[model samples]
Target: MSKNNTKSEGAEEEQPKGKTCFVIMPISDAEGYEPGHFKRVYEYIIKPACTKAGFTPVRADDIKKTNVIVIDILQRLLNSDMAICDLSSRNPNVLYELGVRQAFDMPVSFIKDEVTERIFDIQGFRDIPYNSSLRIDEVNKAVEDISENLKETFKSKGDDINSVIELLGITKAKLPDKVEISAETDLILKSINALSSRLSSLETKNVSFAAPKVVTNAANDISITFNAVDSVGQVVKVSDRVKHFKKGMGTVASIVSVGREIIVSIEFDSGDTGKYTNPVASVIKVINSDN
Candidate 1:
């Protein structure tokens, strides 16, 4: 078998902060030619830990039918907030897929059998240590550590991915009937509509009465930076124009600074007049004082 001579590297995109997890492991030899090990690692170790961390763990072997081979696997990897890989058996398929992710600069967490010496080093990354003994405590600790690491690494890349896709001039896929393959007008229009609905829903809902103090400002055209969330009140951001809003109330005015905390010059309208419950207003709550 032709092994990859070297690993790929790139600047990784920021990860969206969430509890979703993806596991990429070699099913054929994960347990060293043993059947039960696969189930044990995936079910008892991976699944339970992810669930306990409040993450929805996605497994490769659980995929359903698709027109392309492993289409589901690829989809989950791209969609997940974080991913874990088992390099213990040195599975070529797993390594190749890992290479692909590295090509995209995706933040991936790795684990390997303690017995397996480092065949090759991955540039600018670390590996989580594990053993093949199938000890419950060992597996549990590895899983917990990996999950926490993921929470830190890929916590906000969701927006970064969308921005990169847009810069590359590729549109994100949407609902089949709602999406227009060739019509730029229809595609943007639908995206805008979707975004608008999402934003509107967020406005109607109230934050916790004792919600953490967000950005507060004086009535002036001052610089503003804030963390925005999706309709579900999650840290995830939406780019569908309507959801992002533009040209009207609760819309994108112009991005000032677009990293970590989005800095924008928000224009308050007449409706916002005397609505100075808090001045220097923006539609979204401020998550920090850095603005």
Candidate 2:
């Protein structure tokens, strides 16, 4: 009997942990709120709620601070199994992160203090409201509400009621593909960084360097070339005219590289914007190249 019990315990211990719930909320103090208010909310409410919902809570601050980049945060926002977005204070960064999650039609629960007004655009979406006073009983109730909401949201799996994309009848954004960096591209990036550092050092020293113009020109050329080409070897750049099969004529607004794929955002003459992934040639024809 003892041996059987030991084996059962070991098997339980080997089970995988719960899914990650990325907490999108204000990390810093906001106006009209007390210092460390959000932190307390996370600790006393959000964290416990996520645990109750069988999710491991992850906040922006929980990620390794040293050498962290925007891409890391974006990847987390894009890929987390679920997210709990706090609309307290109506923070722009929080809203932006929520938009990114919504773009992918991911599961996310919205929470906010009772005082803050609902955002005009997303006002129709239901949000779990909590008392900002942080009273003990209220806090406990809020936790229950959030936990239950999280569970429901996860179970729905991007149903129309829970997804902005579905509500608006828009296409879901695709996840970035993983691409390895080539040796040549890596070398070019390093060289550019080194050149930029040298320029900064020279500027601080008040050195009237004549070599700057030549080096700067060369760096600009390299940067332009690097920015122009997509992962699939097609040259597409901002402000270039293009024709889309369905969207008709449009001009490129921006190009973003994520992992192995490049996303090109275009604003159509019809006043609609669209994002297409690499191998853009299949859907978009370059009418003119600004590059």
Candidate 3:
């Protein structure tokens, strides 16, 4: 290949939707006692610092809530260029997420209030320590420190492995062939939400629910969700086996996310590909309620 071709290949390799920094932390509802404490940490410290470090900071709040919270978190954890996890209070969910991120060779930084007990397992790992009192000066200093941490992390390109994958000498981590789905799904998700809202509004206004006449009657929507995991624990591709689709073998030709829910298009050997205005239960498993 020519030098220009090599340069273009490298450019294309970069994740095209800018960088995403997944923020994993305890939410107020999860830990009843810490009302407003965690929120302040993100607002005054983490988010600002991560944003300054040239990342679009995202958290669970970015994805609309649904029963598929785990799926949403896992997807973000897998796809983000970097991660900032708050170990404050040592919340179980936060720690679980931190463990998941550790398995990947991605940029990950930890944050914690100085008051929280030292997590013995990750004692050697670097973290941006903040004061529990959250005083402005202390917070500012923490931000500066975290910025330096981020700089070092980016410089290292997350090559320093810190998880079981590294310790066990596991060489083949199952990462996706492409991570471009996140950017496209963002638009698809927005469209789904818009349509959902309009449908809800019509129901409130006493309009009868109606399927459009132009609908393709033969096809249905199927989503390959977290439940559809293969033996290595990777999500099973719904599009991989269209021959036995109804017998629970298929793959997603396309997919869209609405809130915490994902809808996928699947085609069968019989030549039917289902598309729908709203996602529904699949042959593999039923979707959890939005509640």
Candidate 4:
């Protein structure tokens, strides 16, 4: 072929042309798994399977960064041509997204690590279980299994085999008609902005009130002590007592700093725990500080 024609053909080959498979799975490390474990699973196993099955795999994180991440996720869950849901860690987000896919009577392939127990609601559905050890030979076999499953699942899309709607004898959920940004949405945005402004003002006021004051000790030496809310307003240190708007009273069990944001993990009094990012300052009130 001529140079230009050959170049054109190569360019076309590089571009993916097939149905998109949305992979609903844990993007972060689970409590029991090593860090980046799931990442490796996706890279080594799921991605190859999707390609072999003539699909372009799209994960939640693969979507182009957008201001409205939840909206983008919901759109993909509702409208993707097919999906693969990993139930390994029983991650709430993963289950929720899978539920959305099932409710719409969409075609999906289910997979999980051998160690994880199947969810009660979905016990009847067939899921391809793979060894998490990721031995080379085992991984190769899993890739084949998943690729074959994807092809079979897509071919039988009209049967709705794993659909919860079909099992419940209820009408399948339909995607909502796309609508322009409405006045109600605009009002909600304005309200959020107002609340953010108020929080900023409160933080500033708190810093002023919590400013350190010099003191003379009994031995006549200078000393400095900090009051609560001095370092970061409404940001609790480890072991601090806090009350969440929904999760109730909790003790700050751990705090991790990621980039410029702080991730706070709280152990609730009700035996539940949660992790929140920096904006958690708005959702929680510090009842007591370690200081």
Candidate 5:
């Protein structure tokens, strides 16, 4: 190759590809708290610091549709650069989503409402505390600290992945040859990553996840969510099988989250009713809720 070609190849190799970041937060908690706390903190404290540090903040509240929100949010969690989870108020949904993120082994930072107990058995994950009475400078200082910590985490992870790949004597060029469908799917993921990077660059911040694309043919929407822990002692692919329902004529497909556990939603068209006879899929996955 020519010198320019070699330089181009090196530049491409140095570029981190196939990743995005999803911020998982609880808009509500077990205490019936709404989105006020997060809104105030994000708008007043966290967001400006994120912008200053060049990080994109993706929150679940920014999503319009519930179904799309779930898909996009989860996808970003699984595939993104890093995840920031606010554990304030001990929200079940936040905890559940955090579990999913942990299962996928993504880099996540937890924040809490200062008074919430760390009762959950999620060991190792620590929460950053913020007092409501703190001055703006104090809050900004905390955010900057957290941002630095996250950046360090990303650096460490990169080193770790490189070490693992080297130990296994694996190279990106040696990855399994993806089939046509898989290639298309990879393209879809790559597009998301590229767009994510572009948006981050344009915003001069870290890219946050947008809502996911929900595919449904129903006049009135019905959503069923399937979430499972990777408890089967074996790696499971959420997209391993297409879940089908009787009389619905549609299949539930898992869009595997790259770094997190897989979650797939199955939506039935209006007026479609039939017994779902699929053999409970598998024990590796759980239905967090089918509503």
Candidate 6:
């Protein structure tokens, strides 16, 4: 009996821990979420916590089922062994899904930004909170708390699984078209296309934001000095003989002096209107203009 028990313990020790932890959170560039906050939580909070607990973390955007988005989400909500729902901003879509998950009375981890007000209905359930201020120390501690809470929840099955309907002795609602793979394809494709369009729009805006700056320079002035290191690594200042690296010839505008960093504001052959800053050690060099 003792030997059989020992063998069973060994088998259990070898068993895999954690599960495919489906993440339900607001995406960046979405309506409620601003540019950087959602990404910070995903990268620093949820993902690290999941990885620490040996779980595979994935968001709705990560799911690429060529089916219906609603159906695909439903399948994930129902089929996933674990879930972490971020209830920040009380997103209608998130709340609807949370309702679906709650009815199942399965292990669902709730979390929200520290600033977000607690949902009245989900007060019965536990929440592992994260701070949006994103102070490194605070975020790290929040990640630790979330990781520990998830581990505890994973082990304590049915301990604090809260479903309002369950408490009220009502039959739990069934998931939408449970595992109806055939009906999901069209919806999924449409969702993917829409997501692609949004992503493209964001990229265009980013490029527009980073465009270069043009400046006025004295046409005949050739007294500009650029600092560089020769083959022997000596400090060498090349003047009068340096042309634009790309344009073969260029004009130097006003050399604005600000602290230790020197910004070479110039107009190149290429017409653009954004100021680009590069490391002086790497970008600044004297090229032979006599050639």
Best by TM-score: 4
Estimate, for each residue in 57-109, the C-alpha lDDT of model 3 and write its tens digit.
89987788542456688988888888888888889988888877876745678
Report, for every candidate in turn, its global Cα lDDT versus the true structure. 0.53, 0.75, 0.63, 0.77, 0.50, 0.62
Task: Write down the worst ten-residue block by lDDT for model 5.
Answer: 227-236
* Alpha-carbon deviation at 60 in model 2, angstroms: 0.4
Point out the higher-scoring one by TM-score: 2 or 4.
4
**For this target, which candidate reaches the highest lDDT against the unseen true structure?**
4
What residue pairs are clashing in model 6? 67-184, 67-185, 67-188, 68-184, 68-188, 211-274, 212-273, 212-274, 213-274
In candidate 2 the C-alpha lDDT for residue 116 amounts to 96
Give the CA lDDT, 0 to 100, for residue 12 in model 6: 38
Taking every candidate in turn, the Cα RMSD to the unseen true structure, in Å, is 22.1, 21.1, 20.8, 14.9, 21.1, 11.7
Q: Write the per-residue lDDT of candidate 2 for residues 171-290, one digit (tens) a residue.
A: 898865876879998787667667766766656663321111111133342111222222232355678888888889999887666655566788999999998655335467778764
lDDT of 2 at 173: 88
Q: After TM-score superposition, what is the CA distance of residue 118 in candidate 6 from its true location, in Å?
A: 1.2
The residue ranges of model 6 lying beyond 4 angstroms of the native Cα positions read: 1-18, 30-33, 174-291
TM-score quality measure for candidate 1: 0.45
Q: Write model 4 residue lDDT over 197-270, tens digit each, in one string.
A: 67767766644432334434466533223333434544356687988889899987876655545566889999
Clashes of 2: 1
Model 1 lDDT at residue 78: 67
Better of 2 and 3 by lDDT: 2
Candidates arranged by TM-score, highest first: 4, 2, 6, 3, 1, 5
Q: Write the per-residue lDDT of candidate 1 for residues 104-203, one digit (tens) a residue.
A: 5555666667876664545224566765776878877877876665555454344233122333555544424453346886676567667766776667
* Ranking, lDDT, top scorer first: 4, 2, 3, 6, 1, 5
For model 6, residues 1-291, the per-residue Cα lDDT tens digits are: 001132333343321165778888877555555687787788989999988877788788787754546767877887777788898877787888878877886667788887788888778777887777878998889889888777766655444435676667688776566444455876766778788777766665523222122222456432222322222211112232224444544334434434444345555446532222422322334444331
Candidate 6 weakest lDDT stretch, 10 residues:
229-238
Candidate 4 minimal-lDDT segment of 10 residues: 1-10
* 26-109: candidate 5 lDDT, tens digit per residue: 564335444366667676656554554456766777655423346667766665677777776767788777767665455666
Model 1: residue 14 alpha-carbon error in angstroms? 10
- Look at candidate 2 and tell me the lDDT of residue 101: 87
